[model samples]
Target: MVSKAVVSTISLILVVGVALAVVAFVHHKNGTKSAGENLSPSMKAMIDICGMTDHQEICQKSLSPVAEKGSMDPKEFIKAAIQSTINELSKSMNFTDNLVKNVSSSARLIKMGLDDCKELLQFAVEDLQSSFSMVDDNDLRNMNDTEKDADLKNWLSAVISFQENCRDEFQDAPEYQSLMTKNLQDASLHTDNALAIVCNLGDILKYFGLEFNIKPSGGRRLLSEDGYPSWLSASDIKVLALQDNGRIRPNVVVAKDGSGQFKSIAAALATYPKNHRGRYVIYVKAGIYDEYIIVQRDQKHVFIYGDGARKTIVTGNKNYRNHKTQESASFSVLGNRFMAKSMGFRNTAGPEGHQAVALRVQSDRAIFYNCRMDGYQDTLYVQAYRQFFRNCVISGTVDFIFGDSATVIQNSLIIVRKPMDGQFNTVTAQGRARKNETRGLVIHNCRIVPEQELSPLRFKIQTYLGRPWKEYARTVIMETTLGDFINPAGYHVWNETSFALETCSYLEYANRGPGANTNRRVRWKGVRVINRREALKYTANYFIHAYYWLKGTGVPYLPTFR
Candidate 1:
């Protein structure tokens, strides 16, 4: 028989284990409850600050960076957090008296730990605002791919930790009833407001995709050190005389004043803000501007109307034979509300194996009307998003009209100036990278003509309409007049016996002229010859958002194919 003392001791150990199990079970049950069901001390505190629980989701997203991601900077994230906390705390003026009733001595210790996080919250907000100010537009534009990726990754990690901390206040601390509850609820509301700003910033980024890093060939450079607007300014043009017949001439030799003249047109353009609204006009006299031009983002609602397309020309002679394709471009535009009419843009780099360009328009709301663009290979680079060309004439040889943009060309004359080697003709190189970029070129009512001297049979001398620049190279020819010199096989391969055409989107719709016969047109396996209706879907209204742009601008005469 066991001793009575030994048996009693064994029974006591079992009872202690059972008691511990019961306590653990109760803790787990309370932890799993919803925000409304089993409110933690921190949660209650947050509710007290916010004054209500209605905007819980907003708070959650705002605090998401601080609460979930950790060390993240989002727009309004810090602002929302502080404001929400203040709002919630003000809801109960009697919160201080009730605090004693809810929290025990142990709960007060837990609440103190949360108090430590207050500094972190303040730091996060200050850091975000400071970061925003610190990152100049130029710095942001110049940031390399690696630098951008690393910065974004670091920000995301900080946000994750911050969010996780928030969850701890709501779930782990059940003791300090009033204080903990108030902290949690207030933090949540602040996070929500912050998140609203973050989401808006995200939307803007999605559309612009962070303005591309400045490349040697992409950005504008100054030719003259004299402090003058590289291009004509609105103020300079105001003194000029505009004849009733549309001819314009500068009254006096306009001198650059110290007000805002920059080293280069590109430099001037770079300083433009994103959301600013106003009118800007750059009027040029009948003189050749030998320097490269860059129209920047803040130069919105801008009109660069020249005296004559051929006379008031912006000309450069950089060629691929001497310079790289990107370096050869004569003019570049990166403004939102941009327009260029009756201007001659020429890259006289000749077809001596040079990739010279006449014009490159890389803006959201860009329009080029009655303009002449002349170059050889890789000319007229449509380098970015949402560009349009109306009644413009482009002349080039191989892979000329190429780029990564959602572009539309209507009622334009496309001239193919063949090279001496009798190599390629009419290269409409489309650079559609993503599937979301379904917006491609829609050539409507345009005339496709080869060099006047070239015979119809000369088109067979190794000519192609476009080649695969990306997996989804979307280019279309719709209701255009194709000359007899166009190749019977409307499209040609980027390389012989290649698989590039399988994924590229080459479409033609109801194109007329001697070369439009179906039997003779190149029958690529995946090319799409869409109908008039399908082509119109990519036309003025849909692609340009014409109605929206003109709604309040008071600009009559919207562009149409008809």
Candidate 2:
């Protein structure tokens, strides 16, 4: 017979094992409950805000510290997004700098590409900081303030563009390109998340059950009853009222002959006043200036005009064969609030000399009135920021009018020149890489026609309105007259592999001409034929928020569709 001691021992062991199992189960259940309960209000708010973005995990992780500090304001979240982008970009820039240091001197292109990346990263950081400042300064709770919102979006979009441009510099170096892609991925993602939050800010606010006031559209006016911008100062009105250049007193004068104070435009630019409050005018006499002119970044509120577009010219021939596209421009404007009138900028690098830029504008709130940009390829590079071209003429062959700026060419003429044999023509190649970017090319009430040389060969040499230079390229040809030379397909794909047909935005509204028929246009998913209501969104008043700054420039602009 079994002993009673053995039976008692076995029973005790079974009881102990069951008791331990029960305790472990209770602990796990309580731990899960504790985790749920421990989620702070700030953490929950961060989750809610980040959930609206495409990259939720990245967004949440990047913004965790910001959330932990505990204010649930949507603006704070937006600020955190921008801050995160800035931080990542700084790190990426350092990484690029290290790569530059390690690169072999024999690899010139690679070194140049990395150097360009470093510069671009710096620009991206500046742009993100600008966005951050805007968010921090303004009470974005009033979602109806379109001007502030547009400016914020523009800066963030430019950050993305700068990052993409950095990567694009390494197109020929796949290995380097891959390295850049990996290095910039986090920075790009953070910028994208920031832009997404800004784009869907209204929805995010609504999600928070926050109440805000909307500004009435009817209260805003583009111009006063007396036919002038209501916001123009007395001094500005006086300057605009002067019809004759001789009568208007200029701060400086430039002349090829020794009659003026400065013999060259560059000399006149050197006289820019330090922190002057008002417009500083520079007038140039009728002469051809064979110089590469750059209005430096610090030169703001500069009003430079010439005798006439045909008489006074700034010409150069720096093509891609010798210099970088950014450095090949005959004229580059980097200042804000810059205005150029009755001037001509041309790149004499003929069609054979590819990727030559005539006028590269990186200025914000810039105006070009009655000016001309003449080149063969990559003519007018609207590099960044907001630009307005009124009553101007732009002539080129390939991707002539291109860049990542919020630009409007109104009452201007687009001349399409014949390209080399086997080469085609594309008027615009807008470099908007992200959908949330507010940058685009808007051709309003302009004329697009072929030059006399290209007229006969129009049928043989195909021409497209635009091509997707970047993935989210956007161009709107509305209220413009298209010449017969424009291809029936309307637009062209960048290449076989770069067919951004689904992501790019190409729109034509109320366009009239033989080439304006949408019936035969390419059936791209992103091409659209919209009504007036939709077209209004692309107007000067809405697209670039022109009314806010254009009023000061005194350039006549159609705020809305006629």
Candidate 3:
């Protein structure tokens, strides 16, 4: 027979254990950890790994079965996680597709949103498959393997983004919410956990005595002290006749004082060769030449650099409020392989004036370095083909930087000024209409800050990173510093019924500062944190295809990026 004191003590211990269980249950229900640390090594490993992700508990739970199989190899463990991610993504595709079909709403908006979810889910599946395939490389020490690893990480990130996007699209559609809520959330949670492990690829590789870095090649540095690329040759560096500067003569010079080759920029452009084989460099001297300029399609290989970005100003006021954006640009470019440096293009439209494009670039392989574009809306239109913007200062009110071009805006300052009353400021509105379209927007190593005059309560003002102007819109913001002026939600919807929120691809990688904290970001799959590999793909060297021609221009740009 046990003593009465021992029996009481045993009963008390049981009561404590049951109370702890209830606490754990409540914590788990609230989507957080229970307050305890004692766990098995495998469980701890799961926790440790999942801790790096946004969804730790779910990640650990979903990956628990594979972990129990007892493989400690970090590589094997991660492979299993990725495989799990792939499986979930595939199911998610089917789930979203079936959900779309089952919805009873005949509203076009609901249909459009659901259709967007299916399209993005399909992309997620494809990307996840590619990511899984990439994980089977033979050696981790080789550059090929490193590149493959990078590609895998990018695809995985994309998978997570698409999944989140699918769910966010239905947030406003309460009628279809029940169908998408659980499955989409589960799919996103799985990928978020997978990406948490993938984010540590460098450290994980280090654990296996390996590393991943870009192969270094010997080359002249193209990046200037001002963060711009100096592509000018010795001849392009020279001054015009009667400028009194000791610099050499430019190919064609435009001077308001009539001291150079031509008095007006238009006159000089009119006389330009129609079929030039080599670069035709035109130098514009210091002046605010209020005329609207156009470099036609025949003016290929054109290089236009001005005296200074501020000193040489091109100003106009044509806006959609008055005229069409197609005809209202301060400067229009359609020639391929065109370059511009140290110039200012301005559309002097106020916040109320809409669709005023300062610079419209339709040129393929166009490069703008150390340029200033000032306007209210549609300040810089990256219209078509591929383009690069380096060391530029662009300021506007709404959709200031936009269009369908595959563009890389790097090492630039994008300023958002005070908008018209009751209007929100949107930085980018990418128009990638088709899934197969190669056009996208990559804003890398740039500073997105509010104008100083608009900053007393800047955080109170609504500023979004971007919005999807088209269904297949894609944009990546990498290694950038965003000011506190940015909205916590990061991006906005084009409209309550627009399906763009589902079909768009938006991501941020390695960003910093107060605005970069994603805790308050909208729970949309379109926005995510990407790996180094994905971020590298959008650089000026790689994203804009600058390697081929950038070198030829004597620009010391990274020979491997874009």
Task: State each model's CA lDDT, in order.
Answer: 0.55, 0.85, 0.72
Which candidate number maximizes lDDT? 2
Best by TM-score: 2
Q: What is the lDDT of candidate 1?
A: 0.55
Question: For residues 54-151, could you state the per-residue lDDT of candidate 2 as single tens digits?
Answer: 87767876677767788777777888888989888998999998999999999877887788788778877887888888888877776455667777
**Candidate 3 residue lDDT tens string, 205-307:** 5654566654567443554453333554333333212122434345789999988889888988887865656567788999999898988867887878898
lDDT of 1 by residue, 451-511 (tens): 6655554645555667766556778777788877676777877655575666777778787
Q: Please give each candidate's TM-score.
A: 0.54, 0.89, 0.58
Clashes of each: 53, 0, 10
After superposition, the stretches of candidate 2 with alpha carbons farther than 4 Å from their true spots are: 1-38, 104-112, 216-238, 241-246
Whichever of 2 and 3 has more TM-score, that candidate is: 2
| Candidate 3: residue 425 Cα off by (Å) | 0.5
Candidate 3 ranges beyond 4 A from true positions: 1-248, 556-562
Give the clashing pairs for model 3: 161-525, 164-525, 165-525, 222-556, 238-248, 541-561, 541-562, 542-561, 542-562, 543-562
Q: Which 10 successive residues of model 2 have the least lDDT summed?
A: 18-27
Error of 1 at 371 (Å): 0.8
